[model samples]
Target: MTDKQSKAREYVLADLVDATNEVDDAMNLLTEARYPVPAALTAHLQAAREQLAAALTIAKQGDAYRPRCAHQCPNHAHTCDRTPTHLSDHRDQQQKGTHTCSWPNEPDHITIRISGGSDDLVEVEGCEGADEFNCWGIGLTGWRGDLIGGTDTETLRIYAIYNGIWTFAATASDESLPMPDWPIRITDHPDVGHSALVEIDAPAGTRLTNVTALGGDR
Candidate 1:
């Protein structure tokens, strides 16, 4: 993986953590508010919880194979940069392979386009802003991006034209992917003149793959 990709992954992991926290907060708020849990709200809460759990699981797996630097160099030492070659040595000694994803030690943005539709193509905009210092909370607010924010006016939008849609519980590559426990909500913005196209039907054989960066310094 390039530096940009690594940074984007790190930013996504941090956002996952934030999403987990946000879901917890939302659940607590719902309970404290004494609002009767509507079926839809309850379902949404549950789905968010599960997504957060899955994200953490994936993150832990990535962390398990991630390489770490042991030797500390002087502040002025060029070797302290931790290049892929240096990390490769560490990974080899640790019995870890060299296929790990790590790069992009800076803040930037990226877009994920979902294509291969028979009729129309769907494009989702996602941010990938991460600093080189490992600071948290940069881009991709949640696993679904900024698609859940609530406002009097809609900000996010999605629509699907496919006959069938496939939803994966965890990873899309899994054979026995569990069905989505909650409905996927898509919204549109009239003031900003923006829209999002999302697939919701499960039996449509929808396949989700490929994530790309939009545009940035990286």
Candidate 2:
């Protein structure tokens, strides 16, 4: 399993155990009470019981909730000892040069390339129709893609790439704008390609060797 998944499972289990203990304590308090049970206390006990039941349902799913690791290390016998090799190593190799791209309307397609000084070249492209109007931007810190409409509204699925890996990607849309002068309208579809480029931190002593175009859904 991935480290993030493992950590999430651990947190859920810990929360379940604590909820169970609270339920048990509430039950004991009810049984040993010398006075009539207060309405508020009774309501709290009921709530705790319900929460415990819900947590138990999730715990029973077992492997369905926690799957095995999809990728395995090939060089287990190597001298290198890294906890998370894939993510850690990839980030370490991306700090040598600047990765830049231009976002604008294209008649045929838009191509983005990452130059990895003497290393492999990474390129990504998106196509536009013959008559269809296309305008989009690259989101350095989040997911890349334009919404359905050309409105300046930010949506979820935008993620920030940190330490050479994608992280902190989330989306939120609502009826009212949370803050005034927030460039993106809450109701309009988000046009997110012109935002600031995000910088990622690289581990010390690691040099970027190559960048290959990642082909797939962002």
Candidate 3:
């Protein structure tokens, strides 16, 4: 994720914390207030607090939800002493110039895991193998995972690079797809020339849990 994206996430996470703290502080102030406070105004405060509580519950669902590590340290001989959050995406290690969790070097045949997070409209694109934009000679190239009930809908899409054209491969939304869709294969499709790109569009209310996406068969 970019620094801007990370900062946006930080603010998102801070919402619940800030809301709860505000309520607590308000209650404390109310208790210490020497002057008479109107019951009507207090009722409004109580209502606002209730709304914040509800919002927090909804936010917490996405807050606890996040995309897990896309890849782990392929170098088992060398432990990835870095934190889990750092290894969640290969790009992070790549930018840091660390090999602790070098997953980007080998993005093909990789599996994706969806754990928890908001349906914050996330989009990512990547190519597999030596060729820059083709799925040829590559195994499966998609993500397969389950969802936690947080929104009305969620969708996963795939596009194949056939003759330099991004063509639609397949799509699944909510429970439309079953468990273990092993690989998003393009080997059968003759048009798949060089590489394939998988894109996921998650809205604000989405919560995917217990997810896994592998480029090759498990």
Candidate 4:
């Protein structure tokens, strides 16, 4: 880890310790001060504290605890940086293409295009002011990226034109479009001023073409 990352992890560990302490204090008062706390509630607090401790243990390991690539990859738990060689035992099991991290270590903004395609996957090409699709999260964009209809972030919407009709495919953080075989069209809120088109099945000679974004503030 870099000096900055180590420092950040330390800060996170400290915050977790503080939170654990707070929970312990609450449990103590309920059990020792003769307060008539419900038995079930105290049990819940104990469980919460245990969960926090488990999280703290994992946090202490820093990136060592993070998955290296796709979850199904055999070396998923191996602590390789951006360019670590694949462990020999798992050579045949490695992911195709160059090794890529399963996650973006930083925030991922949702201003991108669909730059590539595969049998079952479409590459989300992050553009200026955005980060590449890190292999984990809701759909294409990971947890940090703003989904077209993600409720937690600035709300915009993504629509799909299929069989001569436009249909809603996303509406909140937990909702997003499935990998599409047909051409995809997105019309952003007029105030947002962004429009996009994605073709998952382009002509044979061309790559899955364009997630071209028209003029916008993104």
Q: How high is the lDDT of residue 130 in model 2?
A: 11
Best by TM-score: 1
How many clashes show up in model 3?
16
Per-residue lDDT of model 4, residues 99-123, tens digit only? 4444333333223344212122223
Tens digits of per-residue lDDT, candidate 3, 156-202, equal 43322111222223334334644222222221123333222332222
For candidate 2, write residues 1-218 as lDDT tens digits.
Answer: 56754554455556556656766776798889998988876774665464344434544443212321223122111122225544432312122223322222333222211111111111122212111111111211112222111232422111222112212211222225321111111111123221222221111222221111111122
Model 2 TM: 0.29
Ranking by lDDT: 3, 4, 1, 2
Give the Å shift of residue 192 in candidate 3: 35
Error of 1 at 38 (Å): 1.8
lDDT of 1 by residue, 1-218 (tens): 34643554465566567767877887788888865778777676776576456656655444322333443221111124445556653422222334332322223212223221221223332323211111112222222222222221212222121112211112332324432321222222222232222222121122232221111111
In order, what lDDT does every prediction score? 0.34, 0.29, 0.35, 0.34
Runs of candidate 3 with Cα error greater than 4 angstroms are 1-7, 63-218
Model 4 stretches astray by more than 4 angstroms: 64-218
Cα-lDDT of candidate 4: 0.34
RMSD of 4: 17.9
